[model samples]
Target: MAFVILKDLAYQYPSSTGLVLENISLQIQEGEFVSIIGPNGAGKSTLCYALAGFVPHFFKGEISGEVEVDGRKSSESTLDEWALNVGLAFQNPFNQISGAKYTVFEEIAFGLENIGVPRDEMKKRVEDAMSLTGISDLADRSPYSLSGGQQQRVALTSILVMRPRLLVLDEPTSQMDPVGTREVFGVVRKMAEEGMTVVMVEHKVEWIANFADRVIALKDGQILIEGKPNEVLTSDLLIENGFGISRYTSAAREARKRGLWKKEKLPVTLDEAVEGFKS
Candidate 1:
């Protein structure tokens, strides 16, 4: 079943004179992990908000066409109702922290509390979420006192505990070191493996190649290309349009140009690059 559907969607912010998204349309089936990649200002974040019911609801912008997630249309669904079905975690984790919560544990629990989850169940959910994100040790600390990467993990855990049917992440690890990045990505990938749907906007092509079931390349607020991860990531069109390619993909492309790469298809990860060259 399609968990997310967008048809001919376009948007312009209240104060903006131009369209931020142009005729965007796509459908994400339940349990699919879709990765969106584009340079800054490509409207990736705006699309994330649309999926989470913030574009027309919270932003009060000019939105044309339709956006439906989990069978609820964004044009009509209330933000509160959408929140129960779609969770959004954006890049700047600090912006996501609720100023009302004092401790990290309390902050992660804030969402559950608002939805009237029982105290005992909420406690168990929060603890399990923290453990999944590897933040169990920091649960007692003040969320504000944590580093940017730590706070990002906390924000992710908050969304995870809610168990939204669809999770939209916009560069959720933009501030993290490699290890932290991998840990967070692993947690979300596992969520998808367990039947949750995900749409993530990220610049890290390598990670996307490894875990994303599909990759969507956005440029100038439009979807330039989208398909299976390897196909979209290794496309010459993607490279020409200034979308960042994996380092391995770039190297393989170069080797092909120099008649050193034997494979017809380029590699998008270190392992694939090594194996392709070995053949």
Candidate 2:
């Protein structure tokens, strides 16, 4: 059985006229790294909320269909219990901050403390997660004093320390620079390889192509396309739907049109572009 499952899922926010997410059905295997790409209002964030058990739990909206993880349905599980196996990091780092913690280390360990994790083990987990995201040096610094990118890293580290079975990240790297974005993607990829199921909503198509096992493009509260990274990232349907794609893919598409590129498949990454152009 798939580790995560969503069947005919649709959700409408409180007092909202229409569904924010419509007719969404997906299955993710254990240890799979899936990336979701769409423009603003594509329901990507809402999808993350559903997977994290916040849709009908905290949002208290009309929802239909099933959200299942590890054979347990979200409808049958309490938010507290669902949160044990699923972790969600919001798009805005400030929204994720607890505001009660003074230092970054404490912010990352707050969840563990709330859950009654042993002090010695909590410290180790916090340290390890901070190191993983290259934030060990910022442990003593105030989260409020850090830059947007740094705060984002801290938010991600906080969730990582909990070691949730399913990790749902909404634009986790939006505030990061190119190098930082690469590092974050690398960390998530490594986690997925180590048996963590990850579903990330991101606009960085190049990184998604390089790291994600699959890509799903959503539009108008529904999935428009989903497949291997290369296929989905280079699909013309994405361009037609106003979805962002990799520059390499855009260039390769133009090159193909001009008869300068002979490859049937377009490039989605720099390495692929270089090789395609060379051949």
Give the alpha carbon lDDT tens digit for every residue of 114-151 in model 1. Answer: 99999999999999999889999998999999998899
What are the lDDT figures for the candidates, one per model?
Answer: 0.91, 0.97
> lDDT for model 1, on a 0 to 1 scale?
0.91
Which candidate number has the best TM-score? Answer: 2
Top candidate when judged by lDDT against the true structure: 2
TM-score of each: 0.98, 0.99
Cα shift from native, residue 101, model 1 (Å): 1.3
lDDT of 2 by residue, 55-152 (tens): 99999999999999999999999999999999999999999999999999999999999999999999999999999999999999999999999999
